[model samples]
Each structure stands twice: as structure tokens, then as C-alpha cells.
Target: MKITGSRGAKALALVALVSAVGACGLPRSGPNKAEIFKGSVLKQGDAFIVTVNSRVTRATAVTPALGFSSAFRNAGVVGSDVISPGDVLGLTIYENVKDDPLLGNTGQRVSALTEIQVDGAGYIFVPYAGKIKAAGQSPDGLRNIITKKLDTQTPDPQISVQRLAGDGSTVSVSGFAGANGVFPIERPTRTLSAMLSKAGGVTIEPAVAIVRVTRGGKTGSIWLEDLYSNPALDIALRPGDKITVEKDTRSFVAMGATGSQTKVPFETQTLSAIEALATVGGLNTGTADPTGVFVFRNEPAEVANAVLGRRDLKGDQRMVYVLDLTQPTGMFEARDFLIRDGDTVYVTEAPFVQWQKTLSAISGSTNAANNIATTGQ
Candidate 1:
């Protein structure tokens, strides 16, 4: 069949019109490189960068129960006695007697003034009163024995015992503070707050502020929130007590299709999957393929195999948990999934969207070439 020039021109015009329509059907591409669809598949190593915007919010703030009780039991005695060696005890003696000028009121007068030294055996040496166990004894208890011994030698004598040296007065302050060391509590009554003040207070950064108290070898952990909310937990300080404010160590990494691709600090030991998502600004709107959200975490090989069918060949390798956010039920389940420390969250872009963008670009180039050719003729 011999084709006419006008017919050929009409056919070419029809083909161009059809191509333009098909190009119009192709998805428009802008700065956004990814799209969230109902059912999108993702492959490993695909990069999707999340856009930064003020509208995006993270779930870094935690509102835990204020009245959470500590696991420590109140077993120790209140105001327990603590005595150590090298403690000096001051003793004074008074007596009632008439004055004899030459003898200096020898019958009933203040005769002996002595200071006792606690030896290594926890015993104190006193004049005329042999070794006395003063370590566990109260002031009055030791005075009674000294007075009795003085009575046998002389008349009735009154003895007073006082602590003048404070060698054993010390408390340990540690953790998220400018200064962490063993500080001596100069005051008779020292509280936990006072110790923190002396140690330069808590760290200004919330990510590193955590205070823990250990008294007489017992451990108790307290959050910075508890320090402000629950004052009752911030109890008074005692001798031989240690206060530590440890820097928070648990954190999650947010990367790939998140506004902020960095480590997010968490106060709690474990963070929920939904909470982690929120911390990363809840995925990029135009670029994130929610269905491709995944979390990569390291776990024990045995446990990983039991839970995720992963083998031990990788030797402590991380397990990948892929989450399909397209399904309505995925939202609920995602909330239950917990994220551990060092876990990485990634959101990918839809593959078809990229194809559509490529097709659109190719069609646009073809149209530009056609227009240039027509203008040149």
C-alpha cells in the first residue's frame, strides 16, 4: 500500500499526541525521590534521605510513672553507727573539793585531762584506764567505764567525752558531675543534695544526667526526673555512702530517610519501635516508603536463630527486621516492637516511583528534541 505524505504526517502527529499523553500519565518528579504507596517492595542498600522540616516531631520526651518504687528493701538500720581507727576522743574530769593552796585542791578537783587514741584493734588507750573498746561504743557508754575506774583511785569523778577530730568524716561522690571524687562531709549532717552541690551539681546535658546512691555497699538508681519530681527518693547522706551520676549509655541510631540521621539518646533501657520512629521525626513525608521501614540490630547468634531463623555463621552478626507499614495491623504491631541499643532504623523509597520518574524525564527529553528539530526546519 502506497502511503500519502498527508496521511504520514497525520500518523506522526497521532503518535506524538499518544506519546505526550503517556508522558502525562508518568509520575512527576521534583526534588522528592521517593513515595509512600500502599504496597511497595524495597531492596537492600537502597538509600532514601529524609527531608528536614520543623513540622516533623520526634518522640524523645518520656513521661514515665513518677511513683515507681525501687527494688531495694529498707533493711538497714536508720542512723547506724560507723566508727573507724585513729579517731581522737577528748575527755575531761571534774571533781568537788575544797581548795588547798599548796596541793591545788587535790581532794575533789578536775585532775586529769586526756585525749584517747583508737588503736588498730578498735581499742582506745586511756590514762589509768587500760584498753577500752571504743569502736562500737557510744560516748556515754565509754565515759561510764572511765568514771568508774577513776572512782576506785580517787573520789567521785565526772568525765565528759567529746569527738574533736573528723578523720573518718568522708563521702564518695561520682557520676555526671564536673567533679567526681571522695569528698569529706565537713558538716555533721550532710544530705544527698549537699553532696551533689559540693561535687559541682549534675551535668547540664540531660543525655548524661543520672544519679545513683550506694550506701553501706547497697545500690540504688535514680533518674534525673526523679530528682525533681520525687524528692523523697533523694534522701539524706550518710557516712561510707557513695553517690554516682552515670552518663546515659543507651541510644538508637536514626538513619536513611529521617530528618536527622544521628544517634538519639534514650533514658530508658529499651525503646519501643513506634517511639524510635517518632524520635527520627516519623519518616519523610514525600521521600519515605513506610512499607520499607526496617530495623537492624545485633543479637546473640543462638537467640537470633531461634527468633529470626538466622544462622550462626556470621558470628554475632546483626539481624534485620523488616516492617511493612502499609497494612493497618502493622501500625499496632510496630508499637509493640521494642528497639535495643545500637539498633539502626532505615526507611527506603518505592521502586516504581523511581521508574515513573525516569520515564517522565525520558519523555520530556524526547519532546524537547522534537521541538528543537521542528524549529530548526
Candidate 2:
């Protein structure tokens, strides 16, 4: 009886240690990441994804969400057409015939076109027009001013004012452009695409190119492809606007029981959830919980706060979006659902996988106990 008691004691001790270790080694149900980020979990159908337009109505003081088309238009260099300092003007004056000096005029029909530059003080000096304010003055307005002034010295003096572009307005295009440099804006109605083309076109593919524009300390970006898709957004450029073309290398990570766990690049401007899953090779048939497809993202601060009706949220606050691919509607919805930058697509293991793991743990514990029993005897 004493020897039997000793064997029982050894078996119990092994079982306790094995149980403790197994508990420590096991993975949790959801990703440990969300907990680490202290984010909120949102099941599908529980809350709607706040879109750009909807954001305007729901906003309570966070940075307004950027709409897809508005990003291109709002960031694009556009404003009232007005002349400014550093603009070059072509001036032409007419006088009565017989002034005859530069043209040895038999009669003054038309003088040679004179090029004038707007001084930093916003003034332009012309022979007859003399010290006229060019900046903030329209081409037609300056023409009238010059005509009125020149008429004092010459008969019915007519004047024409043209904006000489070379020395005037220009835009800077660099990064991923074949020929990166300052491109002169010839027409007042030059579009973003035209400016890029004038700078030797883009070296990167437009479909995946992220074009960023910066002006007056404000910056915004849109995919080159998306910009072209919307006609209203292809706005005119303003002088001094900086356009930067960069590769759209943004990606999302896929983990859990997916067929291939990897970081998938967007490759294009927009990617739906279904397309994202397909890009990462989809879920593993043997172990994936089809019902547990989840996308973890640090949603826009405004969107998260609106959904939670909270004060404020961190930029890194994680939001878990569940998808049930087992149903047809779920698949359709996934097709329309857009995947954003830095999102994580995770598919949890099936419930049976946990059972299998539990059984394996039990088997290991039984073997450990048997080994302890033999040693004890």
C-alpha cells in the first residue's frame, strides 16, 4: 500500500506540472495584438463602417475624413485666376506713324513687343505705360491702364498685355518622374496630368502611384489612377505647388490559418476584402474557421469615435471587423468592402482545431505520468 501510494503521488505531480505548462503555451482566441493596442472589437452587422460622406454628418470635431474624389480636388492647386509678383508680361504699344527710331517708322503702326517683368514690389515699368501695378491686376485690366497712359504721347494708342509664362508661373514635379524638375505652366488651365506629362511623364505605374500635393503647409494624396477616374478632380495647378509621385507600396498583413501568411501590397489604388484575401492566397481549408474571418485595422480616429460615441480615440486604436464568408451575402459584402493601408486580415482556427490541440495535450500528459510512474517504482 505504501509503494502504490508513492506511485500515485508521482503521477499527480507530473499531471499538475504538465497542465500548468500547457495552459501557458496555448494561444488565445483573438489576436494578442488587439489587446496590446487596447482597441475595440466590432462584430459584423453590429456597426456600420462610416464612409467619407457619412463622416460629415457624424463628425464631432475630429479631423474630417478625406473623401476619395475630394482628396484629388482639394489637394490640387486651384484658386481664382490672378496675376502675382514674378510674372513676366509681354507688352505691345501702337502710335501714330513717323516716330521712326527702333523701326525707323514711316508711320507708327505698331512698336516691337516689349517683355516686362513684375518687380518684387508688384510694379512693372513700361516705356509709355510707366510704373503700372501688375500684381493683383488682370491682363485685360493692365492692358486698359497701358492704353490710357500711352494715349497721352501717341494718337489713339492701343496696348496688349500677355502673360509670358517662361519666367512666370511654374510647378515642381519630382520623385518617380522620368525627368524631375520645375515645369513651366503654359496655359492658365493646365491640369495635374498635363504637368506630370510635361515633366517627362511618370516612371512608376499610374495604377499604383500615390501622387501627393503640398501647398501652404497643407498636403493631400490620391492614387494617380483614382485621380484620372474622376474628371472633376483633375483641377488646374497653381504656381509653387509641389507634386510628388511615390510608389503605392502600402500593404496589409495576413495571419492565423490563412493559406499563406504574408504582407500583401495593395498593387492598385483600391482593394476589396475579397481581393485582399485572394492576394494572400486565402484561408487554409484544413484549419481555418471560415466563420471567423476578421480584419484588424486602426480605423480613422473620427470613424472609431463615432461608432463608439466616445470622446476621442488614438490613431492606433484597433477595430476588429468580422466577416462570415460561409454565406453568399458575406462574400458579396466583402467584395465591396475596401481594405485600407496597414490592415491585418486574420482567420482564426476552427473550433475542432482547439479540440485536437486539447487531445494532444492530454496524450502528452498521460505519457509524462507513465514515465514518472516507472521512475518512481
Structural similarity to truth (TM-score) of each candidate: 0.62, 0.63
For residues 1-377, write the lDDT of model 2, one tens digit per residue: 99999999989976776567556766634543333224333432322333222232234223213323344465544433356778777877666556453322666577766567788778888774568888877788888887887776666766677777644467788899878888776653378877877787689777777777776576777667767787765666767879988887778888888878888887776687789888877878888887777776666776677756775675745566667777757777677677778888888878677656665777887899999999999
Model 2 clash pairs are 96-108, 97-107, 97-108, 98-107, 98-108, 100-105
Candidate 2 TM-score, C-alpha based: 0.63
Q: Compose the digit string of candidate 1's lDDT tens values, residues 19-75.
A: 665556554322222333211323333232222111111212123222223433323
Instruction: Write down the TM-score for model 1.
Output: 0.62
Please report how far candidate 2 places residue 254 from its true position, in Å.
0.8
Using lDDT as the measure, the top candidate is 2
Number of backbone-clashing residue pairs for each candidate, in the order shown: 2, 6
- CA lDDT, every model vs. true structure: 0.61, 0.69
Q: Which 10 successive residues of model 2 have the least lDDT summed?
A: 47-56
